[model samples]
Target: MGWIAVLVMVSVAIALIAFRVLRRKGRDDGDHGASSVDFSANLALAVYLLVLAYAAVLCRDGLSVSEADVQAEAESLTEMYWSVAPIPEAMPVRSQIRQYTAQSIDLDWPLMAGREMSPIPGQTLADMRATVLGLRPVGEESKNLQQDTLDRISEVSHARIVRSDDASTGLESTFVILMIISGLLVIALPWTLGVRPTRSSIIADLVRVGVVVIGVCFIILISHPFSGLGAVEPDAFKAAQRQYDQIDGRFPAQP
Candidate 1:
């Protein structure tokens, strides 16, 4: 943040100094093809703004999808945990569910920020599925419950994969580099019109640069799913853990 502030100040100082030097030398006589300069500046500004807008949309969509995936996984785990109660051999399965949720909240959440997935949760979930399949359902209702439990497990798997994928999702590096270059160019365009270094002109230039800095910075901050000020939280996983606590405490006899 300090460096960013310094950079902004330095860029503004340079632009102001250049404007003053050009004006003193009578180089900004407004006679060097004003129309052509206006056309090029306008075109650059248009393209820069369009790219920024597109990047903003992508960030928004990624955030929304990631949030939804978290909720979906949590809900599916809750359902699967509940669905196991009807089977006689489901106590171990219930324990597995609890372990998976605990590991996800305690281990997976932090690892996800670095795009690293903890294998324990996946392995526990797979074991839970195998254990569920091994349960011998003697009645139709028990069979149906088993099927539902399997379906919920499937949902949990899908949601978990999606959450992992989104953990590292963001604007591509190429696009980010392009955005930075274009943002700088956008701020530089005003000076190209040979505008005089009057107080009003300098203030306008400063304001334009400040606005671009804020916008570009904002987009970059939110682009990553697990980093920066706008990064997504593990609220859904936390809620799942809380639910597990409630359920696990209720069944003190089961371990």
Candidate 2:
């Protein structure tokens, strides 16, 4: 994603020089054509920036929600692990919890790039619920603990749904198209004005092109929260691994 800006700038520079070489006789550098083009071009630039800003805000909010979802799920997993610890029949459930976390961090997280997720963690969670359901509690306290465990499982499931939504979220293609068209218009309008393209004017146009490239690339990078630069990582799950270690007092990574 970072390379996108660099590539755009290089390509624009080459194209600009080529167009300059093929230039014909220019019209008089009069005030009328320059002012009209300049005004329209400025408006184009402003519209382009506003669209990028809106897209950026959308992506940023998605990223924040994704991070929060991950944190919530990890915390739920940790709580569920502790909830199942006291039930003798639920020992296997602890292992299942660990497996789900492992699959989520290692398998599901990567698949989020394609707006997909692995079924392994989901299946593991279902199995854990079944295991807890089959448990027989003795006292009211044990029943309460069992209910707490089930509630944590539900919380984790809800968090997963939110995370999945975030993974699929991104800027709309229409916005991308609009941004590209407007940005190109900004770069090309001055040329269409027939004002003489002097060395200084050409240099200024190149700088404008650079700004457009940067804006376009920045928006593309921020289009999604699950991939590319500044993506929402599985750091929360990594922390959950440590939490599990503390909960189990040294449980291994795998079942």
**lDDT per residue (tens digit) for residues 1-255 in model 1:** 443565567667876687677577634346567777667767777877888898889888888887888888889988887777656667888888888888988888888777677998999989989998998887998899999999999999888889889886777767666766776776776667555667676677677678677777777777777766567777877787777667656544343
Distance from true location, Cα of 3 in model 2, Å: 11
| Alpha carbon lDDT at 173, candidate 1 | 66
For residue 82, model 2's alpha carbon misses the true position, in angstroms, by: 1.7
lDDT of each: 0.77, 0.82
What is the number of backbone collisions in each predicted candidate, taken in the order shown?
Answer: 0, 0
The residue-by-residue lDDT of candidate 2 on 45-89, one tens digit each, is 999999888878887887887788889999999888888776666
Candidate 2 lDDT score relative to the true structure:
0.82
Q: What TM-score do all the candidates reach, one by one? A: 0.80, 0.88
**How many angstroms is residue 236 displaced in model 2 relative to the true structure, after the best TM-score fit?**
0.9
